[model samples]
Target: MKKYYWTFIFLYAAFSTNAQVKYADSLLTAGYTQVAAVEYERVLFETQDPEVRNEAILKKAFCYKLLGQYNEAYQNLLRANLFDENDSINDRLRYESVLTAFMASKYNDSYNQYVQFKYYSKDTALVDQAKVIAVLALNEQQKWGLASELVSELNESYSLKLDTAELFAVSKRPKIRNLKKQQLATTFFPGYVLVREGQVTSGLLSFTLKSGIVFSTFYHIIDKLYFTALLSGGMYNVFYAGSTEHAIESIKVNNQKKITRFNEKVSNSLFKALETSNFLLF
Candidate 1:
């Protein structure tokens, strides 16, 4: 009797149609967390099969969250909620995504998610988790008063894992922050100019338009992020870089009216082409 029952149990567990629970667990054990997440997502698509879809999805969101892919987790949680908005689990998942986003220092994203889901989750564990995480996230975003209130709430919550002392330590810990990249500006002013990284490129000088001699030429972008301005240097000295767009170049027209007008038309065409290109860096 015992042998028969053991065999029966083994077979039942193996032949189960709900593969998500087993697959996700197996993948996690095998260190394929991302693969587990994918398996769970597939289970979510099969509506009739309700074995462990929620569990699987939670696992998936967790995997993404652990891997520091907060955006991916946030999207998955959002999709899962669309299927069953009332699922407290989805609310919890939203809160989890918010925490991950906070840890990742994506303050704007985290704050937005927190605001959307804070009212829905009633679980003490999840609520405390969110409050604690959100306070720090808000602090990172320079919201001091709100953080203090959140911290105060956490301190008074009986279900909180830590007391006020631990809260201080957790809040003080450093999170991985987003690095801001410095973007170089591209400005052609009203005519042909050379742009380069770190320093201005060569060939901007000696570009002369004869007085009353209008001429147009398409200056090729020698490289990426470079600008070729077909400009009538009449009055304006366009400034676009960090601080100074000074009236650097002095413009003069040499006697040659008809030729200068033709130049203007050609330069205009080139400028249009450059504008259409995506290579122009902001």
Candidate 2:
């Protein structure tokens, strides 16, 4: 009976219509991501097994990440981490969880998990990669003090051939160059409020900077620039309040695109006006 199921798994995994997922492990091994994504999604529907599901999810996310769909890839990477973080499956999920978090730019998450990963494997290469990522993130976030500390802990000799001192200097360039801008951005997008039926609320409505907020912010700014006022706000609210992490966590996309667009325009205009007149004390 066990053999029968194993045979089914093997045959299904072998002959899958998704040449990508069907042959992902091999393709990944050979660095053929261009052909791996198709099989990954196919594998999603091929089996209900969590392990298989996770493998497919990671591959799919990796495909998107490589394709520059950073947001989509991050979502899938997050899902895999959430699943694998459980004590029941942490051991099996550690490698992918750590890898996905790094790919998704969730440095703190990957770094925190690395301490756990340290006890589970002897793959020095993976360790080196993880440490670099953690340092890179710290560098990006302007914690250069912490980044330098972490860098010192790493064995500089293990760096890849391409990761020379000059490249390392260039790597820290993001921190040095964008340090001011990142700090200012946090304030630029301090958050938003919830307005309904002529009433404005804050706590249940404030939409702060987050993975989801970044998506909506970019969308709204684009929409406003295009003068599609109604459509822009609607889209913004849908994404902004669609989750608790957003605003009210109750905004609907289809029902409120116009309102969302208008609200954003008004808010943006007000921000500009305030700055022009120096009415807002920053």
Candidate 3:
């Protein structure tokens, strides 16, 4: 009778744990990620089975990742036992560790983790993933030369190679615009610097606005409209003083945008070359 009672308790606990896991999975599927994460934590606290605990932790990490809480996801992954003798779990944990670090903009840490994972992993697929992540991390760090070399070593497609080459070229030989020269140009002609920077629309708009203000001020002055002339002069002075600075800022922003787009293109090319869509979330 006592043995049967103990068996019943064990069975009840097992059933409860399974029910919790199923509920959490349902919540995750229903897009209640926050609730699902809490449920997973409950399962983690209640389950003694190593596999069940690991699954709960991984699912909770995924929930955090979906919520854009990469730091939380990374911390959760760190709680996983690495020497659990489960190759699949260990590989996924390492991969996610690198991924979360990268997502958090900890590029150096991501690169170092990838290096260690690559050296230790015998699995070809995991190694390939590590290589791709390492290259991406290096790119984020602005180590374009090293990233390009890794892409080459991976024997990526010709198009991807060209993309990396372009990235390297642009990174090394960027268009250097002198802010002082641009400011001087804007001082002489309100939109001259913008036009030179290929921002024709902005340049034309600036020119038209400034020209209108100046013409109105001069017209008021000539017509002896003293109050109107004073107001117009004030407007002109305000715009004239800020125009060069605005144009310089716009030029810098545009240049930075171009570099950002270049980097994105290289990153996309790298991901495409590795066919990361199968394994990667982004």
Best by TM-score: 3
Better of 1 and 3 by lDDT: 3
lDDT of each: 0.48, 0.49, 0.73
Encode model 3's per-residue lDDT on 78-123: one tens digit a residue.
Answer: 7887667767667767877888888888889888878867776667
Candidate 2 per-residue C-alpha lDDT over 108-137 given as tens digits, one digit per residue, 9 for 90 to 100: 776666666666656655555555556555
Summarize candidate 1's per-residue lDDT along 174-205 as a digit string, tens digits.
33221111111122232222322212322233
Models 1 onward score TM values of 0.46, 0.39, 0.59
Model 3 gets an lDDT of: 0.73
Q: Which of candidates 1 and 2 reaches a greater TM-score? A: 1
